[model samples]
Target: MAHWNFSLLFGSAVLWAMLIPCRAFPTGAPASACENMLPVHTGVQPQPTRAPYEFLLSSPSFLNGQPINIQILGPAYKGLLLEARSFGSNAALGIWKTPPNNTKFLQCSGNPHGAVTHSNTNLKTRQTTYTWLPPNSGCPPVVMFIATVAQSREIYWTNVKSKVIWKNPKATCGAQMLTRTWPAAALLSSMLLILLVYL
Candidate 1:
């Protein structure tokens, strides 16, 4: 009888342990996530299938020092991290506006507000928004938005990406892709129009 009781107790403990979640990031993503852009849920791989969420950019183009709003839409998720990078470079670019309720900013690679991540792990939310402020002058002509979304500890997606967003015709590309977003750009357009009319 004594042996049976001990066996039952041990089984119960194991069951309880299995029930508990492995929440490494109970508050938010760790600082280590900055470089890898990956969550700390070690041993678990991001889902190979397509992510259910999508990034909706408020505008197709953005201006220097100007902000563009990006929203994640789709199935409910537990945590997420978002970053913006120049089209070709792996480096994250731009800062973010203050994080909204239940969200926080993650600084990556010396860039303040370089990234944004979830503040609450229990909140299974379907949507979130972020406002990105691109570099004032020197930045790529096009920006790419990437993210990691976790539906649960074991279920998540990495390398989530959005379509390339263009820099406003009024804002010059700092590097990567150079463009003349100055008064001369407008003057050149006017010149082209006049040339077309004459021809």
Candidate 2:
């Protein structure tokens, strides 16, 4: 009886150890996390101490429709959620231009590219670069980068904000490839008609 109990307890312990790391946040943070910017690790609290992470922008100012390079600097971390925003606003701004390897964007604030998060929690790195593209027309005079860095499943820092960057007043917002007058669907239909006639 004692031996059986010992084996049962040992198995349970090993199972818990294996599950604790992978189950909570293996794939990535959930879409629900967009609102509060909180991880789904229920009951686990964020670190009160300052985040070791910081942002390194390619330039102090950004231009519309152009890519701005952003780098996260610090000791290696397991995962992160990064977003560009106005100083006092919670909504995420801009679109991600080709996210880094092992990462993907989350649809937050109704924007398809609202926030960027790691797609693979197993890959840990200190230096990762992300590209952000501001919308062509709507932009505040200044924008900031905010992020939540996770060192592990239970250890993370939230609301890490960078110094604001001004928008270039002389920025020439690039011409959009598509517009309301010439929607993408209409273009697709035209191509199909041409193909059918040729066939």
Cα lDDT listed for each candidate: 0.81, 0.82
Which number leads on lDDT? 2
Reference-based TM-score of each model: 0.73, 0.73
Per-model clash counts, in order, read 2, 0
| Residues 31-126, model 1: lDDT tens digits | 788767788775688899999988889889888867898988888887888889875566778889998778898878687688888888766454
Q: Cα RMSDs of all predictions?
A: 10.2, 11.0
Q: Give the runs in model 1 whose Cα sits over 4 Å from its true position.
A: 1-23, 124-127, 176-199
- Residue 24's lDDT in candidate 2: 58
Candidate 1 C-alpha error for residue 189, in Å: 35
| RMSD of model 2 against the true structure | 11.0
Q: Which stretches of candidate 2 lie over 4 Å from their true place?
A: 1-23, 172-199
Q: Tell me how far the alpha carbon of residue 64 in candidate 1 is from the true structure, in angstroms, after superposition.
A: 1.1
